[model samples]
Target: MKFGYLSISINFARQIPMLNPTTGEIALFHALLDLKNIDMNFPSTTGKKKTWADGFDPTSATLQLYSGLSANGIVKAREKLKALGFIDFKSRGRRKSTIYKLLDLGSDKSAFNSSDNSVDISSDISGDNSSDNSSDNSVTLIKTKQDKTNTNNTSEKSQATPHEQKKKFSADSVEYRLAMYLFGKIKQNNPQHKDLTESQEQKWADHIRLMIERDNRTPQQIKNMIDWSQADSFWRQNILSTAKLRKQYDTMAPKANSEWQTQQPRKRVYE
Candidate 1:
């Protein structure tokens, strides 16, 4: 991606802390903003012309270079940014880079939705609905125990509910075997790593299930990815969780293919 200057509004910048972004999240957000700018200014040289509407589709390495964050940091920070409504990701495909859409910070839209209600960013930050009445659409940054609890609860419920809904998988199932295989690899990598609870194990199994059923990955492909991710130096540390493995599958696939191909034994014939 080409370099482009960011022009963040002062009002927008002020509300960032209210969203309680981590240092990595903040840096990644700015890096995305830069990408957005680049997309708007530079017309496509070969492919379809990209606009802000089309969104940016930079690779993980590109993001790491721009944001000065590790691969793991980019993933975690991207998830946080989505939770805070700072950004959204649109999947291109299993192999293509995902398109990132930045949300309008000054809008009255809620950062996230709950089962019962939409959690407004302003109310969540200030711990009061009155902040929404302000003529200027800016979130108030106030630190309160209740506010912290509300944010944490919302984040937890959103992430946990999906896994909790997953049906049980038996030991003989491929999902279960893959989950166990991953856990075993993790233990081998770090002896001090804590063992998974029953619920945690089930959750990991569910992620593998999604990989096969939803992502259209074959059992063999998923196994290969698990093996490659676990054995690779950088991915070993970052892909400790099956969830992370699923999230990064597309990005890691090409590299894994190259690695796998190089390891194949070459046949020789006497001439």
Candidate 2:
């Protein structure tokens, strides 16, 4: 459930347009195309919380409410987008939440310009039009036609390819869902910890991937790892740190025994 770098990156690459559509593999894609930045610690307004219309996805906003960045509804959305290769998030943990940086979409800039005439297709279509008295006019017309054709080609190429549009994975994927579950538990246990940055999430995903590789485990194994990680103090402490666990302990101390029954009290008897 806890994502490491590799797992997060792979999931992100799968979600974004940076992977090969045909093979469902990561390609020469960059994360910047979908996001420019991430800001987890943005101050919340006094009134009602923002909604998807306020630039956050509705589903993710709900998830964020239960996650580390509960104050700002954009946290979960940002994390999901980053994991999907849409943005890059940054954080140091001192603030209430993390920060995110979205990368610009990798649009072909020249396609947006109206003046580029690199492709000369008119000459190909008009063989004898150049020989007429009004050859100049004919040439101009041909150039315009060529420009249109070039523009169309550019537009098609700029659009997402079929492979890119394919949906290979979702939050329901065993790995991703588990990660979300773990994040929710962590947030529940330690509400004070700042949201996990993109890098940190990726690192966690990578750690999970490494464990998978080391154990040659199946997806089921990974799921079990997540379950164990959430329940096991040693594993969580090893991955997160004793300091973090201590914080969780402090937060849960009041209700801890009642909730978990770590120990059983002696039975009371009245004679």
Best by lDDT: 1
Q: Give a tens-digit lDDT track for model 2, residues 1-271.
A: 1222223333443333333222111211112211211111132365543211122122333333333244343444445554544445555464433433333233222212212222111121112332331322211110001133455432332223455333232433443344444564454334444666654454344433333333233333233233335456754544352123222332333343243233333321100
- Residue-wise lDDT of candidate 1 within 172-211, one digit each (tens)? 4557666776776676556457878988888888887766
Candidate 2 regions with alpha-carbon error over 4 angstroms: 1-175, 241-271
Q: What overall lDDT goes with each candidate model?
A: 0.58, 0.33
Candidate 2: 10-residue stretch with minimal lDDT = 137-146
Candidate 1: C-alpha RMSD to true structure equals: 22.2
Q: What are the per-model numbers of colliding residue pairs?
A: 0, 29
List per-candidate RMSD values in Å.
22.2, 26.2
